[model samples]
Target: MKWLKFKILILIILMLQVEAKADGIYFGGGFYSLSAEVGNKSTSLSNPSAYSLSYTKSFFPQISFEIGYSFLFESLIGGDMSYGPQIGVRYYHYGTSTNSTASLEGLSIHEVKSYNPYLSAGFSQKEFQSIKSSYSGFYLGGGVEMGWKKNLSLFSDFKYSQLSGPVQGKANELTIIVGIIYHDF
Candidate 1:
């Protein structure tokens, strides 16, 4: 009876370990670059560096939701400074599996690399000559994350946004970001 109880305890511990790898919350911050176009202008104003912060929650091993904010450091054609919030969904693809679904059974917990692609939409408020205007848009982008430690990873992505309103002509913005995430396991 003692040996049987020990075996059951071991089994329960293994199951808990697998469950821990399936869900988590992560917070990250990084640098970003932005380029914006105004009116019919062929030349777009570009800022080489900006800052951003984000939070992501994983409900499954391969799926997560993210919310982020970015601060553009330089003045663009229509704005002196811009800041915004964005929300998106991320899908993780592991290894060479064409299906890209995450399976916990027999999966190694030490797996460190994955392909993550995401889609998002948000609103931005731009301040131009002391006047603030709001613009709404959607972003499409994809990125990859590489695990550095048990609960830490490094990631980068590029996104393009098409915004409407708060301007006379069509406005488009492009951004690239690189950051680190700390996951609660």
Candidate 2:
């Protein structure tokens, strides 16, 4: 629990420093499929869901830093609940285009593309209730974002997380998230 507190504290400090330059803030909820093996029993759940909220700031031209929390609505391995904080870096790929006006102006003007695809990888801490177990691990995922309106975009993400704890042997979760992001918030 001390480590979790420390991670949260670090994220809080970063958030405060990045708040004025935050590029976007998003909230999302989605479904997760979990497969876990403990001691002698193996279990799989296909219907549980999770909700996430995050803040992001651009650290480079194509890279952004993010911090967020994910909460599971159901238990894992008969535990009361599981949830944690996540910190990740996202890389955006922007397509290049040629503008005819560049020749006349002696300069290039690229059109602002509405579709952005990104890859994300992060570390997370999972704490389980009742069982009093805590697991820390990493996740990798990728998704796309499409502009929906001014200052708003829609995004979908799919990530896989593997965690291990003293109480629970190993747990893997596949999560799919669909959410909206508001820019410059």
Candidate 3:
């Protein structure tokens, strides 16, 4: 009976000890580094470092909708290299703000006062010089968001980007990026 009472007290203490960060739409920009392989050859690109601007809006404290656009000089350009568009979802949890595996580890959501961890999944399409030889694919990734201030957040994402077979058998592009996110609306 004593043990049960103690357990309940501990649970309540933890619940009350959580902190509130931000839990709404997060729109911002950052740089991306992409690498991929083409048949027997492999390539990597850091500069001409493309720009990715995004909007992350949340309906609930745990879930949100995200829309973003980015431009890059794909590792290998069979024809023309250009930027692409991406659309997807982002789910966040502020209960784990100190985790190193967070997507937005350096950002904060001031809607509540608790954990600061999150996961995101999205898709992107890469347009090349030739329509018949384009590259596009979907990805699933997750991480946490930490608060540097009230509006600044440092984030990292690991994406597995593959080329669509409809666009021909092109090499696959899997990328990971770490950048800053600033909240606007």
Candidate 4:
């Protein structure tokens, strides 16, 4: 009886370990570079370094939702500054495979050993330090995520945004980001 109980305990522990690889909530932090162009000029108005923090929920195999905040401040004297909230959707292309549909019932951590790419689109509201006013915008971006360890992943993203209120002609913004995310296990 003692040996049988020990075997059952070991089996339960194995099951719990298997459950740890499932995808769910994620928290991420990253740094980005921002540049803006006015009118049809190829020259950039300002190039600033910024940072962001985000929360993400992977609801299904192909869909995930994210909300993030980014801040850009050049100096304490307020040379140029911008801060905003980004809400976006990520669509994952799992590709075609014989077992793809069955495996996607829940994506396992091992599935990300290869580079997983996704496209994202969202809305943002930014507060500009120069004008002391808020502006809303729309952005489109794409990124790739690479699995690192048990519950950590690295990602790189590039985004382009068009703001409603233009500083000079029409402000077109571009941003590139690199970050790490921790997944719920």
Candidate 5:
């Protein structure tokens, strides 16, 4: 019947729309904690808790790529402070990751599902007022992402960054974020 055929066509179109939505640019904001270490100083350098904004695009059904920057500042001794940015990447699948930390050297096996579990590794640095001090290192951690509604979802990750440069120290970074994704319905 004509009605039956029309319904089929509409269903197909809707499916395509959802498929497209599954992969696109996602942007949102939330809180970020910067692990303070790696700089030249005896006192611990802590960047003031701050906000972060990030962008992600799904290259495939289960695989998505993301990059973002955060700002932080903390007071040390008399009239001294530090702050800077962090960048990262991920490669994930249904509740599992082939390798969350992808780089120019390791790049392969994109996503193949709707749900993605991921790991992140990145670096951040800041300048010290006293000795041109710098804190820079890499973070290693994992996260899971779920779609709660159309173009919106919840995201969270746990990571550890090791600091080594002027002074030696270690820090733990944890983040919980809720966001309105532009894609991934």
Candidate 6:
């Protein structure tokens, strides 16, 4: 009986410790622009607008995994619209004197203001006429998140991707994104 009680006490203590840690799920949406070049020809597509939705799971205060989907209103290659899913891991770094507290829905929350830099690799497929082309590549970028409230923030980032596939030569792309994030603690 004493051993069972001791085990129960240990479990309760561990739960309390976990509750004190900062870990949560986050959802975000934003707008993006993509520019691409294939071979010696740059796509004539202008500043096309795209939308993205993402979900992130933070296992630690500074590290998280994110998965998201993006849909372009117009194709960078010109004929039809394109869309794809992406997954990546991100790391967050806080500034020395950046900390704040706010009340959201009557709950007090804490956050840090800083920059987050990340590297990601993904694959996407676009169809032109009846021909389907696939692209796979990696991108590196960094961004800043400014906390608006305890659970909400605004952010922006830029990424450069180098892709190769059935194209005449390597296709290079530059993307810019601006968005808002909501955290569920």
Q: In order, how many clashes per candidate? A: 0, 0, 29, 0, 2, 0
Q: What local lDDT score does residue 2 receive in model 2, on the 0 to 100 scale?
A: 91
Model 3, CA-based lDDT: 0.54
TM-score of 4: 0.66
**Which residue pairs come into collision in candidate 1?**
none
lDDT of 5 by residue, 22-91 (tens): 4434333334454444445334433334344566655665555556654333431234434455666666
TM-scores of the models, in the order given: 0.64, 0.73, 0.58, 0.66, 0.54, 0.61
lDDT of 3 by residue, 1-185 (tens): 99766665555555444433333233333344556565565655554345566666556656767777665543432233556777777766643323111112233223322235567777888765543455677867665565555556666665556556341345455455556665533
**Candidate-wise lDDT, in order:** 0.55, 0.70, 0.54, 0.62, 0.49, 0.53
Q: Pairs clashing in candidate 5?
A: 48-73, 63-111
Worst 10 residues of 3 by lDDT: 96-105
In terms of TM-score, which candidate is stronger, 1 or 5?
1
Residue 36 alpha-carbon offset, candidate 5, angstroms: 5.1
lDDT of 6 at 59: 64
Output the lDDT of residue 29, model 5.
Answer: 37
Predicted model with the maximum lDDT: 2
lDDT of 2 by residue, 87-167 (tens): 998887752110011111232222223667889999988887756788888999888776665456777888899988785
**lDDT, candidate 4, residue 19?**
29
Positional deviation of residue 111's Cα in model 6 after best superposition, in angstroms: 4.0
Ranking by lDDT: 2, 4, 1, 3, 6, 5
Candidate 1: stretches off by over 4 Å: 1-43, 75-79, 95-110, 114-131
lDDT (Cα, tens digit) per residue for candidate 1, span 63-99? 6677777766554323466777778766765421111
